[model samples]
Target: MDANGGIEIERKFDVDELAVLPPLIDLPGVQAIAEPVVHDLEAVYFDTNDLVLSAARITLRRRTGGDDAGWHLKLPQNAGRRREIHAPLGRDRQGEADAVPESLAQLVRVYVRAAPLVPVARLTTIRVVHALIGAGGETLAVLCDDRVQAERLVHEPASAAWREWEFELVDAPEDLLDAGQAVLAVAGILVSGHASKLARALGDRLTAESPRNRQRPTPTGPAGNVLLASLGEQIGVIRAQDPRIRQHTLGSVHAMRVALRRLRSVLATYRSLVDPTVVQHLRTELGWLAAVLGGSRDEEVLQRRLAGLLDREDPAVLLGSIRDRLTTRSAADAATARHTLVVALDSHRYFRLLDALDALAASPPFTATAGQDARVVVPALVTKEWKKLRRAVRRATGTVPGPERDLALHEVRKRAKRLRYAAETAHPLNPKRAARVSGFAQKLQTILGDQHDSVIARERLLRRGGVDAYLRGENTFSYGRLHALEQQKAADAEALFWKAWSHRP
Candidate 1:
């Protein structure tokens, strides 16, 4: 699925400008080498004046003359790999600064906010491609030797020329990248110091403008550093999920909401390390975003779960328009919810929230405790979360099976989740038994989450199936049966939660 969006898993090397090429078809996993093909490609890269995309290891460009020439957005996926998205050149063939494809722009909206994406660099490449074929005549990889002319789009617009070799995997395993790198390394070729063409093209100008290289104040204490790093990771996850959500990718909305919750949980758990007012504001905004995503996600979940339940039910009990009402109403509700979610995602308010989050990641407001030794302070924070979880669990278990208990169990699930996140953040330098607590919290969380889902399902069946279908004169027998099943599922989940909690570490 990750590769469905054209993930580029490749390795690159900088070869001497006039260096002779190495032997053609001798690398590992190569059965034959296809005839060489040449392409003269011209590209223009875009970014803010401050090089926001470049700083984040992202590149957006419009190119012509290549077989796949169009608008390309290359985003960092992992080490030595990028998720490349391609869209038509559309109206920006002449390289209009503000004419970036809206589809691509939305993916980077969190970064560029209101900033214009102007031409930052231009590249013209004379690329000779050699395809390395593997078992069963599969094209394992493409090797390109590119002689390039790059011009920095600045006040003076400096130009540089160089030649480099690119080995990109097609139908090859990740080990192929390392294998090819080894083959190239033996021939006096090393990995390129520059990360990409845009990075190389910008030259020292990139270093001068990129915020990543700029010096900052003294580093925070260990505990503060750990918390901030966790926060940054969650922020990265949210940003990465943005395009997936826009594309209606399954589980993206839920993944994004989880990231938001983790971010808020970190701030709340480590409140003593940061300024109260600022942390509170960030948490409020994160909650707002999560709620907005939850609306669409909950609807979709209900519809899907009900559909699955219907599939397993006996045909004899299925009566009236119950399935139709469920399908029709849920579909409409999910669509409306999705529309609202998209609007919220594109709103100025959401952009401002993103800005706040970025600011928080860049430089957080720290209190005196932030300077303390993490060994002494971090344990207490995790302990606090655990204690809260214990209290919630006790209250929830003591309550009778009713709405109040359902609410209490939900509270327990939230607390357990917070503990799980805090312990995970502290897992790296763990000394406070974080692993044990995290294991217990994770199991408890899963059990309780199932119960909460059943709670929601029951309510949905009552409202959508019971009342709505009743008003329409459709027999409500199926709704009653489904509702009873949901009730039993909730009871069974609660029993599992208590049994698991008893032996929790």
Candidate 2:
């Protein structure tokens, strides 16, 4: 059997109802039971040298328990989602107690700070399971009554806490929670305060992992060598989200996109730190990934914006089948776009790109900028970014306020964003100056962001113009309207850009 199960939904609730006055009386066919048996569980968790699992907010444990128990590796599958893998007892969840599993440890190889996985903490849970099934006999909820004991890292003295819950799941028509809640309400049972007993027990320890501290030392020797350390972190994020995105495990696409953008942004920001040729190669691949995913995101944004616009207008002035037409075409486009993203992810090129990036991160080819110590080097970096912004503003000012001007300003906006991120990364050394540069870069980016959104909206319409005519039986009138609005926004952005640019030092 597969050790890993796909994403599982786990929820918890309080048992105060039966504990307090007026015990659960509802349920025409059911009788009430006061006491139930609970068993104590003990588990020690481990992670790789870099704490990959923890950095990804995943927890792995080896536990001795009540009914269903074994070595468990719980990996994150998006917000409030997790994939639990079970292995036979006596061995570490990853393989051995002292050493990390090669397969799992490979994932964190880039940040191998510590030598081996160590005992982080121990958790003991007293669990009670209640069967809530219907006459046709399907389980609706598993009411679990729990009391927990926790010990800090390396088998320190233990701590204890008591709690109870009803874990609701989907096996019936209505929400299992509603029926269970209705019964528990009469008994004065309230939902659990913490999301999970483990979460509550860990307290501050849950928030211990930080990526920066986990980073491997910058490979060194000579000056002018640029380190792409940040890119490795970004790639790690992308890989971590891949399986979740495949599962459509909520917010996966957005998270993946953010990771890609951060990697691309790092390339753009630290152009002087690393090899431009390599950066260019990486950017092209990143652009392809972004474009593949951008279609769905763009349509999502347009549908939302257009619907908001139509909502404010008189229903009569809406003209044509705007909502239906957009929805029909958008759904088709979204499906195609999703397929493209999946295929691209599976391609050999993508893997090659990842391999290349990992190599670069490990031993970056830094330029002259890398030679200077962070203290002497950072301000000059800030100044270089300021210069780029100044050049963009200059190019944009002389041009007439139109499509050409909009495009130019958008380019400037891109530069500003790159500078802002670079400044943020350098902020540890010179907090005050870095903050000022970041703030100004942000204002410039905002102006450009509005303009760029308009530009993309127009590009999307042009691409969809033909498809809209064939499917919706129209010449893309709605798209045209959106394009016009976007152009106007671009015009408006020119005024805003100049106003914002003038304020920057």
> Highest TM-score: which candidate?
1
Clashes of each: 0, 7
lDDT minimum window of 10 residues, candidate 2: 217-226
lDDT, candidate 1, 454-493, per-residue tens: 9998998999777888887878999999999989999999
The sequence of per-residue lDDT tens digits that candidate 2 reaches over residues 1-505 is: 1354445555666653247323333443234433456777777767553344565566666677766566666666665666665655644576655444444443333333234666666677777766555555555435666666676553233565666764545344335456566666666676666655555555554554334324332223222322344565577787777665665666777787877776787677667778889889988988778776676566666656656655765665545676676567767777887788767766667667776766676667778777666565555666777788788778877877667776678788878887887776665556777798888888878877777777766675566653655475764665566657767877788678778777775
Assess candidate 2 and give its TM-score to the true structure.
0.58
Question: Of the candidates shown, which would achieve the greatest lDDT relative to the real structure?
Answer: 1
Candidate RMSDs in Å, in order, are 3.4, 11.7
Instruction: Tell me the TM-score of each prediction against the true structure.
Output: 0.91, 0.58
CA-lDDT, candidates in order = 0.85, 0.63
